[model samples]
Target: WLRAGGIQGRAILLDYASWATAHSIPLSPFTSQPIPLAHLRQLIAERSITIRRGDILLLRTGLDAALKRLAPAEQRAISTRSSPDFIGLEAGRATLRWVWEQGFSAVASDAPSFERGPVLGDHADAEHTLHQWLLAGWGMPIGELFDLEGLAEYCAAEGRWSCFFSSVPLKVPGGVASPPNAVAIL
Candidate 1:
């Protein structure tokens, strides 16, 4: 249907870390899969493909698995804030630098924030460095927690490298990020 709407194309799809699979909830076997960051970087390098500025870079951390385990009240609390068990500052900085070097317009993850949670360590004590660098400095709007398993499967089978992406966000003003009701047709 989307292809009929002029959305078909070849593309390389990336699936980020999934908290559900990492935790072994078995909701989606593909979501549970892990594609190392280095491997992803290598793929781009091998292809000599540069991530253009304004391109979307999605990161899947599998945090949703943990998010699912929490009580509804706990989930609400974390919707705006991240737990301390998330990635750390050093890792976040390195990740941010990599994404910036690749010239991505935005960098996103399944976890709430780009940096690790406060509970995990003291490194992320600073107020969201990842946000400052990607959003304030680079003018990139990060997308979070997108469902990518289906899209990934399509790309893997067809060996495409790029596809048209479409999305619609809620009209709420001053929103930082909205849950993805987005898709890539290939």
Candidate 2:
């Protein structure tokens, strides 16, 4: 990230990996979590961490098992959407508000969609809401399905809070989400 002038030692990555039950159980982070966005905001605020526009946020949601169950063809089909999970629009709005308040300019998650799955009610536009809110609303791009546990453990061990984060996405026009190969070099 130094090459890109983002390595002045103030990068933080958030985890966004959550698992969906074999039976439908609201897989999105916004609704399923005991500690929702408001609580997350409070936690960060208490820690004196500031989220700003253009800042990179990493999220970890344990959805890899579900991904593995999909056939290769199925996985390809789902990738066309902005996210693999269904995050509701209301939740999307709430998340955006918190993200902006925290000062994040960018966000990433381990799940396919940043929103909840099987989106219900009038908010059928869950995925759309998530993409538009972050990309268009916050002017923040998003990274999808990143591998964060290993690097997070490393960071925890080293007692460091900053690193160089980089991602390369496919140059596909009209693509909602890009298949990216990303890495954080500490």
Best by lDDT: 2
For model 1, the superposed segments whose C-alpha errors exceed 4 Å read: 1-12, 16-39, 43-50, 63-84, 87-94, 118-120, 125-128
lDDT of 1 by residue, 1-186 (tens): 222332222223444333334335343211213233565675555535446555666544446655677899976765555333453223455566676676654455555454444423444425436666666877766555656556555654765545667655554567555555566666
Q: What are the models' TM-scores?
A: 0.58, 0.61
Which lDDT value does model 1 have at 155? 53
What is the lDDT for 71 in model 2? 94
TM-score winner = 2
Model 2, range 1-186, lDDT digits (tens) per residue? Answer: 212532222357543232123223455332323225654454355435555555676655555545667899876876676533433213555666666676755666655455544333353445545566666765567666666677756755775545667676656567666665677888
Query: Which portions of model 2 show Cα errors greater than 4 Å?
Result: 1-10, 16-35, 42-53, 65-92, 119-128
lDDT of 2 at 65: 43
The lDDT of each candidate is 0.50, 0.54
